[model samples]
Structure formats: structure tokens, C-alpha cells
Target chain A: MGVSIFGLAWRSLMNRKVSAFLTIFAIALSVALFLGVEKARNAAKDGFDNTISGTELIVGAPSGQINLLLYSVFRLGNATAEISWPTYEAIAARNDVAWAVPISLGDNHRGYRVLGTTQSYFEHYKYGQRQSLAFAEGEMFDDLFDAVIGSEVAKQLGYEVETPLIITHGLGAGGLTDHDNRPFRVVGVLRPTGTPVDQTIHVSLEAITAIHVGWETGARNPLADNIPEETIRGFNLTPRTVTAVFIGLKNRATVLRTRRDLNTNMTEPLLAIIPGQALAELWQVMSTAERVLLAVSAFVIAVGLVSILTSILTSLNERRREMSILRATGARPSHIMTLLIAEAAVLGFMGAVLGAILIQIIFAVAAPILSAQYGVALMGTGPGLVDAYTIGAVTLAALFLGIWPAITALRRSLADGLTVKV
Target chain B: MTQPIVSLSDLSFAWPGQPPVLDVKAFELNRGERLFLRGPSGSGKSTLLGLIAGVLEANSGAVHVLDQDLTELSGGQRDRVRADHLGVIFQMFNLVPYLSVVQNVVLPCRFSKRRLGEVQAAGGAEAEAKRLLARLGLSDEGLLSRNVTELSVGQQQRVAAARALIGNPALIIADEPTSALDADSRDRFIQLLSDEAQKTDAALLFVSHDGALAPLFDRAIDLAEINHAASIMEQA
Candidate 1:
């Protein structure tokens, strides 16, 4: 009996192939968009939360928490104020400090920023928890003049090992050129991290100071130019000030105490923010954008559902004779309703599954560009909890939207049974 | 004849805001009897058929079919009776165009367990449906799986006859079933309908305005002459 009803539904759908195909296409497209939005939303959250993974605290000169997070983890903006080298040394010397990587900013190669830090920056500074830097090609920086470039910098600039690149003195393309006379040789390149690190150029702290040593009285020194590079290296080249410091605690329990001490007794005004808390604060500040995106996607889905309803309702008039025939065949009003409801549910389910598969395909194709350009990695792994929830929600919405027309069909069929005319 | 299978007592019906359409003192249909009900358009011929099939309730009086008062039965029970004991074939659009020929004939069984049981009891439902289709002169090669829309009007009418005759219903109501056919096809349709009705031993109430088909039935009644109140209401 169930088989016959299903056969009837199949035949009815086939009889109106054009309309059925159009309806299925609308459903498929809507499901794709709905699932795509869901995937991007969760991916954004994952990328944001994991931006500074494995780090306990970020210490910088007093500034907005968001700024500190953006610069220290994402490498987006520059630090407004710098912590003196003594402050970094003080923080690094503490008993509870397991590792500290002091970072110096304020330089750029073309548009990409150049970061100056120690070897520990590559070894101990992690993004995703315990995720060490993996070098796709050559080794990490070994000498003062040799540099390690990010994956994006290598791909965009077409730089290979031994390629000489000069640095400018500020954040952007228009920044003042500083290291014009002494270009650094690219030594190694880090693999894609899907973070801002992918777009940065990393050098040693000594190299950062060495590039500035030629300046006397805030002007270029003629004597410094004539001196051979070997002779000039004899001068003290240690950095006096650095942008920020990343601290990893030997024990997790002492992070709070250490943060409090830095806030209280630090000679310079400084702020220590837990990376996770700072990330959450950043997410809160950006919640409006997320909400706007979600609301727009939802509205689009609503429009799609409305189209489905309108199409089905409009076709009801043309199908009057068909409905009457079903009635004459002894199909109850509820049976007619069930056929419609089942069609809608089936369409919604198929659309969702197809949409999710499309999203994963899109992610796979775009992963490389996303890692380089936006520093956001979209993996092609199976759906997570959030993806599942979105598909389920969209399906339910489609079914709910379908009910009105199913009821309409039922009512029309019942009225048709009474009229006895086609 | 045995006790009448259908009896209409003082039946009167009218369209809303219109004059009376049907008012008959009595109408009886005996078991296995073939009756021709002749009436012109707007003479309440189809309305009476509607009442007898319980598709529409009579505004006054009672319609009894198979010894049960149609008016006394609930709407669901009326539907059940129609599904179980009565088969109706309309003039046109009788079959669901999307369904195959055999599927259309098996529709009544889908609705009523009693009809299904009867079909199954007679050497399985499919076998019975095929046998009936064969008797109706439908080709076995195309009859079982052919969509009803693909058949000519004459062929479709024959398929409809077979559908109405399936499950051996106690009564069959055909409303101008051959009106759309040519004269020759109409003759063939009438002969086929009568032969199939005799085989099932079901009372057949065949309604049509064409008097040429009247001789095929055992009895004939002119609805307009028999309905006195219908004419009086029309005059008033």
C-alpha cells in the first residue's frame, strides 16, 4: 500500500517534470547557501579562537586589549607603544616564565610586515595548541642577515632562498626605507599556518638593531657607510625597545599571579591579557558584523522558502483535476496532504546534503588561497556539530514552509470532491 | 426481484439560491438490475447520482443503498460505503492521468480493506485487475503499465469501466459515461458496461440523455416526469 502511494507520487512528480525540477533546483540552491553560511560562521569562530593558541599571556605597553591581541597574534596592526628591552628581560627572567619571545615591529617588505624576534619565536610560539612551526622548504633563520619568510610572502613576492630583500621602516608600502644599504638574504620559509604569520617576514632581534646602527643623531652617518659590514658588526646591536612579548608559563597555576604582578609592580605601564580572554573580547566587539551576516543569510533562505511556497500554491489550480481524480480513487484529504509534505521533506533533505558537499568542495579548492590571503584555513573534513545543526535547522524550516501548501492541497481536494466537476 | 439494493424516499435537493433540482417520491434499484435514468441537462440527473453515491447529502428525505440509510451514516461511514460497496465512473476525467491503467483500476482497493480483501480473495488483486482489463478488450501488452493519458478517449472509457467494475461492488454509478464517445464507441461502451455489470451481478444505474442507449437496460425512467416537485419548483 505504501509502495503504491509512493509510486503515485513518483508518477505525479514526473508528469509535471518542469515544475518539479524547478522546485528541486530552488531547494538545492537554498540549501547550498544556508550550509555555506553556517560553515563560514563556524570557521570564522574557529579561526578567531585559535589565533593565539598555546600562549598563556601577551604583555605589551598599555593599550586597548583588542589592539594588543590583533598585533601580538594576528599581526594586523602595530603596537602604539613599545616596552623597553629591560621590561622584556624582567618578564623573561621571572621564575614562573617558561619561555618568552620578544617581538620588534615597525618594518615592512613591500606591503608584508617584517617581525624581529629570537629563535624561540619559531620554536616555542604556537598558534594552535602545541602546534610548532613547520618549514615547508629551507631551514629557519640561522644568521643575523638571513631571514625566514612566511608562506604568503614567498608565494606573492616570488622569493626563493638566497633572494635579497630590503626592509622599510614602517607598516605599509609607503613606509620610509631603512635597510636600503644592507639587504637580508632569505634563508627558509615556513609552511602555511592559516594565520597572519603566513604573511610576515621574520628576522632576529640583532638584525633589527643592526639595520638601524648606521643612523647617527637621527640622520645617516657617512662614516658608517664607508665601514665594512664586518667592522660595523663589532658595535653593540642589541634592541633597546620591542613591540610586545609572548609569555608561556612553566605551570598553568601561576599565570594569574604573574599577570597581577606585571600590572602592579612593572616599572613601565604595561598590560597583560590572557590570549583566550582577549580573543573573546575581540569576538564580542565584532559580533555585530557576524549578526548582520547571519541575518542576511537567513533572510535569503526565507526568500527561497517563499518561492517554493508560491510555486506550489500557484500550481494547485492547474492540478484541480488531478486532485479530483485522487479523491475519486478513494484517497482521503490527509493522504493528499501527506504526499505533498513528503515531497517537500525529501527535497529539503536532498538539498541540504548536496549543499554541504558543495561547501566542502569549495573549501578544498580555496584552502591554499585562503591560507595565503586571509590567513583563515578552511578544512575539507566532514561536518562538525555546527554544520550539522545548520543543515537540520534549514530542513526543518523548509518542511515548515511546505505545510501551508500541503494544507491548501488538502482543502482544495476536499472541496473538489463535493463539486464533482473537473 | 430481490430486496432493492438502493431506495430513495421523498428525496429533494436544490442548489443554493436556486430553484429545486430534484424532488422524487420514490426510486428503487434492485440487486443485479440494469436501469437507465434518462434526463436532459439541468433536470437533476447528475444531482440524483451524487446523492446516491453520498458525494452530496440530500437536503430532505433519505437515500438508502445496500440496506443502510446514507443520511444516517456519518460522513466517514458514507465514504467507507462508497469505497466498499459502490463504484462511480464520471463522464470524463475518470482516471488519474498520471497513473498506469492497472493502477487506476486498483485505486478502489487502496481505499477500502473490504474491496482489497475481495480482490485478493479472487485469485489476488493484480490477477483480478488484469483479468477484468482483458475482458474489457484492453491489450495485455500495454494495459498493465501504460499511462492512462496515452490511450485514446475510447480506450480510456473502457479502462474506466473496468475500474468501476473491479472488486465486484454491489452497485455501480456511471454518470453519462459514454457521452464523450462517438455513436459506435458509445454502443460498444454500453454493451461492455452491461456485460461486465452482469458478471459482477451488481445493480447498475446508468444515466444519460441519449435515448438510443435506453434499450440496453432492463428498465428505463425519465427523471423529469418522475420528479413532480422539481417541475413545480421550476414553475414557482
Candidate 2:
């Protein structure tokens, strides 16, 4: 049988192994970067969307929609204001509300946000297709100082069921007084949800009020030292103010009416947002950055292809004699073009596959860190259809990119057939 | 008696935006004839070979090889004729360096169905390639597998010759095929190439500036004597 032209192309590439490898590596790295960025973007959007999947409305003190979603669901930037206890009560009493999980923030446990809420949070708070939180180890918080820690918080802090979790008076990395005397015990650790909830320490509303009852304003009272945990039940621990209330409507159709009522409250101005719409709005805000990332990666791929073109064109000068040989052996100008195109296609395909393997290796190393720090879970290291599409598009682009050098080779062969310059 | 293997009539050619380089009123090479074409550098030696190979088309008139009027054929049809009926060898030993000696020898058969069919009739492409190489005294088993880059200049020359003579093409065009060889190897190479051409019953046109090689061929034609453009160039 005749030697396949593709086989010839392969042999030609193998002839210049060093340049072929360099070109393949450049293309692979660029493809890896493009694929990595795209995966990270999708993972981030998935994490955000999974944060508060079933919440119908988020009612908070009148604030920006993005801010309310951020502080309430994402545990991102803090809410500028708080919804009053009376306003929260009135909203919770409405017939349209099925269950409301009021969130009282402004506390942290070793940098993980400490969310103060009722048992309703553990019971009704849903995420990722209305999947309720399941404990990885133990049961929900029952005692006054009992804490339900998210999966990441437990993993990072190495907290077990009985580990003493000290709550801080505020949210930042510095200058916050710790409630060391009234430490909470880790009661439960939630399973990985790939959401903000995985990064929070959940405590009851009474604990939020109990920890700061004696602190006058932001200052610690010297006389109110060492309040015993046993006596905490003796004190009234009703939360007077919460940051936001996540409401789930009894009927999905009543969401608009309830939102309008909350927004038009005469007693106190409140902001209500459907969590899904807010998340979509957040995606809108982030889509620009996503597009920029894709654009930059695409530009890098273009640069990689240009480098391939340059390498091939440079080799074309050296291969002028080779082209003449092919011409002498009965190859037409079109055959020369096909040979170059085939070589480039092989390079592109090899690079894409190498890049995919590289990406999987990178994700394997970075997955744990990403989940721990950003709550963005990279579920698996396998390639998806999008990855296949990317490789296909890149290979096709490479075939097209080969035209310049192929044309150059064709012209050279036609001009210098079987002629030795010497 | 048989139609000439190659016939050019009133052929004229020139580089674009340049004066005519070749104006041959008539040129013919009979079947199985070996013709030595002598010309100086820049005297249209390579240009005439290009026209004969169908790589270049004359400005006026026709090049008929194996009874096909190359001027009447489309560029692609001319390529087909070149592939099926003609073999070319260049002076620089243009063996695709990455390919094995066997691979380089069989390359013509890769592009031409007719050549491939001929090789198949001789058992297989590789076998025919090996047969031709052995006829040119390149039968070392190790050398056949080695890349052409590893071969000596003379060995490489034999490989090029084997490639050109593989499929029993009607005509063989050799452009300074021995220019890069030493005198001993040059004579040996020409003997092997001419012997292979005779075995295949193919007409041979060997172009070179060296006049010493002319006596070995069936006939010698000084290109300056026939290319009218050469006389005009000499006058200017």
C-alpha cells in the first residue's frame, strides 16, 4: 500500500522534533489556560447559584439588591443596614410565608462567618436543587452553646463534635473581641454543598444575643465578666435585630405579592429580592469579567497559532529542498498544501489532548484549595463536552492557520522544482 | 519510428516581466534515448527542464510527452501527466531527510497511482523500491532503514535515482544529478542511472554545465546551439 500522506506529515514533523515540541507546548499551555479559566468561571457561577437555591425572597433593611444577596446568601460583603425585629416579625406573620429563616450576622468564628438563626435554618434552608443540609458527622445544635459548622469550616479548623468554637464579636480579621468565656461546642458538621453555607458556622439567634448582652455598645463591660454558660437560659435571648430574612413562600405564585408588600411596608422601608433573580443579576455583574477572561484566552490561542505559523514558515525555508523533492516525486502544489495542513492539524490535536491532561492535573492539585478558600468546588478532573468543543475548535482553527505556510510551500515548490541552487 | 518520448515545437518561455529565457524552435528525444544537455549557469538549463516537467508552461507552443500535449492540458492535468509518465532527479540529492532510505525511494509511488500499480505488480511498493536501490548498488539492509540524512552523498544520490526510476515512467529528467558527486562517484552514478533508464526503456534528458560527461550518453546537445534566445542573449 502507498504511504499515507498523513503518515508523511507525521514523519516530517518528527524530523524537526525540537520545533514541533516547542510549538505543541506553546499551544498546550495556551489551551490549558483557556480551559482552566473557563472551568473556574463555570465553577464559580455554580457555587453562587447553589448558595440559596430555594429561597423565594430575601427581605432586608432597604439596601442595594446585590448587597442584600451578597450578605444574606453569599456571606460576601456585609449589609449596610439591619432589618428591625418588629419588621421581620410582621413579614414572617404574613399568610404567604411558609417559613422564614432570619439571619443575624456580624460575628465570626476564626474568620468563618458565624450565622445566627433559628432551628428553621437547619430545617428549611435549602441549596443545590432544594437539597436540605445533611450533617456529615453529628446532629443539629440543641444546647445554648452548641454550633453547627459548615463542611469547610470543620475541615479547615479540624473541628470535631466537641471542639470549643470561640465566637468573635464582629466580622473582620482584626481588632474584634472574642467571646472566649462563652465558647460554643461544635455539634454538627454539614456535608459539602459547594456553597457559601459550606464556609459558615451556624448558631442559634439566642446565641447571637447572649454573646453580646453585657457589652455596652462596642465596649466590654468590666463588671459583666464571665457569664456562666449554665445561666445563659436565665437571660432573655430574643434577637431584637437581624441582618436579613430568607422567606420561602407557601405558593410560588404569591412571591410577587409578598415582595411588593415587603417593599411597600409603611413602618420601615425594606428591600425584598427573589434570590434567583438576584443571583442572575450577580451573574450579569460578573459576565463582563467572564467575557474578558475568555477574550484574553482566545487572544492567547491566536498568539499560539501565530507562533505555529512562524515556526512552520521558518522551517519552510529549510524545507525548500524537501518541497522540491516532493514535487519531483509527483506531488502537485495542492499536495504540498495538504501536507502542511495535515501536519498543523496533528500538532493542534496533540496539543489539545496534552492541554486537557494538563488541566486535569492542575485541577486535581487546585480543587481542594479552591473549595476551601472560595467554596467553589471543582467536582471532577474529567473533560466535559465544552472541553471537547474547545479542542475541536482549536484543531479546526489550526488547520485553517496552516494555509499561510502551505501557500508559501506551494509557491516555493512550483518555483524551485528539482533545481539545486548550488 | 515510435513517437518521440518528448517533443517541443516552437516553444517560447520567459520569467514574468523579463525577456524571453528560452526559445526552442524544435526539440525531440526518441524513446530509450539518453541525451546530455549542456549549458552554462543562467543559460536557461533549469528553465528548459521545468518546461519539460510541466512545472512551467511555455509562453507559446506545446510540450508533448508520451503523446499528451502539455500546453493543451490544464495545470492539474499537466501535473497528472508529470506524476504518471515522468521521473525527476535533481543535483542536490533532495531526499526527504526525515524519511528512511526506503521511504524516500518509494515516495514517487506514493503520489502516482500508475507508479504504485507498477510497484504492486513487482510485489509491493517497498520491494520495488528495494529492487531499484539494489540495482544502484545500495542494498545494505541497515541503510534502508536509516533516515536519508544518515546516508553518504553517493548513497543519497542512488536513493534519488532509485526514486526517479521506480515506476518505469516513459521519460526521466535529470537536472545536474551528479553535480554534488566526486568524479569517481559521478561516473558511477551516471552509469547506474543510465543503466536503470535503459532497463526501464525510458528516455533520459540529463542537464549539466560539465561537458566531460557528454561522451557517456547516446547524444549530446549544447543548449546554446538550439535555444534561439541564448544567441540573442549572447548578442546583447
Candidate 3:
């Protein structure tokens, strides 16, 4: 009446401070994992959804759609074949077609992908709700020897306007050969969009053309045959083939007809696919992984809750005295039950708070790694509306699960006499 | 308008599938009476205390406290009547280990709103608890703040006594509360408890097997002389 039962429960927990602390810790870690996994899942989805949008269809070599999307859009695996220049020209000149941008991927600049495209890429290419790419500094490439670097390339490699960049003949670190003679000038740097585009170095398709003018059979030409960089600009530098093409249709209604025409009626083999379907398929593959992650975290939470149950249940035999003391001092059996249940509820609330703190710590360490490795953006840091709901659910579950031990103590105290053995 | 604090008539009890352990014909402690009942261990003193506290159900006859037949009340009602009326003290482990001395002393009021109301009218439970503990000679501020488990046996017994006497309950049941105290402090403990109980005009039912301390109470009864089942169990 004067001293509150909640206070009594808290003091009782404090009496067993070590066990209580361990319980809170286990619950906090599980909660952090639960919320962290959820954050990563959301970031992965958002990153994929934001990568490239507003394009009606992607056209590429006869390779599978995922492969073509991987190399052209994602810059993941290498493209095994190329679409002829006339095929790209034919798709660009279609009646329903609006514009086309060629993507030629074969070179790398210091671990970043090299993408050769026309000025149409900066003009028409869109991402994340049809947002256009804006230059952070400088402007788009103007000549066959000019290049535009992405935000990460500039930030990581310390490139700025007039920074000379050498394109390697192949992908990855220390590839087959370096294009030392045909080095390009950094003309522009685009702002970060949290997409793979941030990892690309852009140039005119002719820039990809002029670099290999002396090379044959995928190797460097002899020293005598190597053309000097000063005289190479006039040598008919047009791309003969391209890795992929992004096609946007002016008339949205004729996409299927145009795709069918390209896939079935073209002299050159080609593949046209709606990006949404491929993205959905990718999500389907990823969701299974997410489900496994969710199940694992759910079990961890269950283990955390079970530890509370075990802690209380085992303490009951010894706590019989505590319960009897309460009962003898005018407390009823229901008060004892409330005392135990209230203890668990308090621990659960503390667990939620600790979980929030722990999740912020995890996100702080994971954000940059995620952005760099997977291009996923991890945005929020603390508990949100959904997090509050989850905390409530976990706390309520702890309180609910706490009843078994309380009921057990109640039964024993009822059976035992008010006279304590000690 | 004077009435006995507790009256039992033809009470008999036993654990299930066992012989009768307690059978008493008649017993009563009058208003403001301090009665000592001496019974050695295994004489069913604990079972009697449990029944009187409304924590146990008698197999037959009536167990009455505060003029209410405990047999006629539901389990919850009995718990309520106990909370509202009785203040019990065991021989040892009397205080909740986690609570401070004052918290232990005021714990009865947390369960009994009636007692809480009485405490509040007396200028708050903390002040009333301090008054009771001071009477029991445990008024050290440092001592009061420490956990009850850290208190010596004599101090623990005094704290337990103060707890029982806090809300002026209708009946104070102390079962061998001085069993752990030395001879010197045991007598002092009883004097303090009885003096505090008399101030509230609350009846005391003190049970202990030690007969030497029996003279400190207003009256005394021997369990073997009154409980027929004790003699029966001895004979069989």
C-alpha cells in the first residue's frame, strides 16, 4: 500500500543483479540482431529498387537476361558476347523507340568499372524515381579522350578535373595490360546516388574505341605498330560492337510489340526484358535468404525469453521464502504473481532500450561497408514506429511467458505454510 | 461489544491420505489478550498458524478470525481477510532479503489498503515504520538503510516485530519469532513486541516451545494439554 509492488519487484531483481544483468544482455543482443537483420533487408530492397528505374526495357546480346543485366546494369560478371553496332543502331531507329544508350564494358580504372557511352547517357538515363544524374564538379566528357568519373571513383582515387586516368585492358586489380598511351582526362565527377553508377567511370563509346586501335587478338600490338597518342584522334574511332543497350520507348503501349520485333525479327540475335520482372526474380531469390535470417533472429529472441523463464523457475524453490515473507506481511498469492511478472516486464523494457543502443552501434560499423560492397544505403539509426511495435511485442511476450513461473511459485507458496524454514 | 480476536471450535485437520495431525475442541483469545501457546516441533503448531492466518483449509469445524468463519469464505476472500486483518511473523527469514529495514516494516501496508489508510492517517508509512522500529531499538539511519539480510538475528527479529505491529492489525501472530535470539535479547524482543501490540490494543498469539518465556505473556497454554491429536499421535 505504501511501498509499491513495482518497487518491490525491482528490488527483488536487484537482489539477483548478476542473473538479471545476464538476462537483459541476452535479450538485448537478440533484439539488436532482430532489428539489424530487418534494417539490412530493407536496405537491400531499397538499393536494388533504386539502382536503375524508368527505363522500359534492356536490350543486350543473346545471353540470358540476368547475365546481361549483371554485366551492363550491375557491372558484375563479364559479358561473353557483344551485340553488333548495326543491331544497336536498328533498335535506336525503331518507330516506337525514343532513345538508346550503348554500354560497352571491358575495361577498369583502378578496380572501378569503365562504361563507355554517348552524351545521351547523361541526357536520358534515370535512376531512383526518374532522377537525373548531376555533376558534382566539372561536366560530361566532350571528346574521344575525355572521361567522366563517378562519385566513388573520384572520392576513393582522389580524382578531380584534369586528373589523368589510365584504363586497364580487363576487369579487377592488375589486369592484363594498361592503356598507358591513350590516357584520358577526367572531365566530370557525378554526385553520389547510392547505386552502382557511383562505381563507374564514363566515357564516349569512341573512347573505348580509340584505346584498342593498336591492340589485336586481346593483346598489345608490337612497339613499331603502336600509334602515338598525338596522332590517334583522326582514325575513324567508332565502336564496332557494344556489350548492352538501354532502350526507352516514347510510346509506352508498344513495348511488348517492339520487344517481340527485336527478339524474333532481327537479323542479329538479341534479348529484350522488362527490368521489373528481373528485379522481382532477384527479390524472390533474396527473400528466401531474408526468411532464413528472420527465422534465426526469431529463435534468438525465443532463447532470450526462455532464459528468463529458466531463471525465474529455478529461483522459485529458493524464492519460496521471499514469497512467504510477502504473504505473511499481508500480501496475497496474487501479489506474489504480480511481483514475478512485473520483474520480467521490467527486464523486457530494459532489453528494448539496450537493443536500441546496440543496434545503433552495429549500424555505425555496417553502414560504410554495406554502401561500398553492396551499394545498399542504411539510413535510420534508432527505434522507429515499426521498431516500437516490435519492442512492444517482445516485451509483451516476455510478460506473457513469465506467467508460467509465477503460477508455479504461487502454487508452491499456497501449499507451503506461512512459517519459513529458515 | 468486546469480542474474542480468534475462536476455533471442533477444528480437525490432516494432509490428504494421512492420519489426523490436529484436532482441537475449543480455543479462544479474548480482545487485547496476549496468549502464549507452547508446543514443541511436530506438534502441528505451524498447521494451526496456517489455518489461523487463512492460508490453509481445515478439514472440519470452524476457524474464525475477526468474527468471520474462514471456512465460509472463498480462497480469495480468505486472502483478503488475512491481508486486511492479520500480521504474521515466522521464527526466521522474517524479512524480505531484498528490501531495506523500513521497506520490510512497511510491507504489510502495501497489501492491505485498510492498513495503508491507517498508516497514512498516522502521518505516512515511513514515519510510522520509523516510530515502530525506534520503539524496537533499531533507529540507526545507516542500519535502517541497509538490506534486511545484513541485520543480526536480534535485529531481524525486532524488524519482523515492527512489521507485524505497523498497521495495528486486529491480531498479531508470531510463531517462535524469538527462537533464533539469545536468552538476553529474546526476553527483550518479547517485551518490545508485547508493549507495541498493547499500544494498538491488538491481541497477540505467540507460539513457542520454550516454556521459560511463557511467563512474559498474559496467559499460557500447553499444546499437549489441549490438542487431543498430539496425545493420540504419541499413543499410536
Winning model by DockQ: 3
lDDT (Cα, 0-100) at A305 in candidate 2: 78
Q: Is candidate 1 or candidate 3 better by lDDT?
A: 3
For each candidate, what is the lDDT? 0.80, 0.86, 0.86
Cα deviation at A257, candidate 1, in Å, is: 5.2
Better of 2 and 3 by TM-score: 3
Which 10 consecutive positions of candidate 2 chain A have the poorest summed lDDT?
A413-422
> How many residue pairs clash in each candidate at the backbone level?
0, 0, 2
lDDT: worst 10-residue window of model 3 chain A: A374-383
Q: Candidate 1 residues A1-422, lDDT tens each?
A: 32366566667767777877776677667666666666776677787776667788999999898899888788887788999998999999999999999999878888888899999998887776567888988888888898999988999889988999998766656434456777899999998776778888999998888877767466567566676788657868789999999999999888899999988888899999899988888888778787787777777767766766776678778777777666665666667777776666655655666667776777777766777667676643457675677668766876787788888887776555534554
Question: lDDT tens string, model 2, A106-148?
Answer: 8897789999998988888898889999989999888888999
| CAPRI tier of model 1 | acceptable
- For model 3, give the RMSD to the true fold: 2.0
Let me know the TM-score candidate 1 reaches against the reference structure. 0.87
- Categorize the docking of model 2: medium
Rank by DockQ, highest first: 3, 2, 1
Sorted by lDDT (best first), the order is 2, 3, 1
Off by over 4 Å in 2: A172-176, A378-382, A420-422, B230-236
Q: What digit string (tens of lDDT, one per residue) describes model 3 on residues B1-236?
A: 67788999999999789788889999998889999999888888998999999988999999989889999998888888888888888888888888888888888888888989999999999999999999999988999988777889999989988889887898999999988988999999999889988999999999999999989999999877768886456754
TM-score of each: 0.87, 0.93, 0.96
Misplaced by over 4 Å in model 1 are A1-3, A108-112, A134-139, A149-193, A211-229, A232-235, A250-265, A379-381, A384-403, A418-422, B15-20, B121-130, B140-147, B231-236
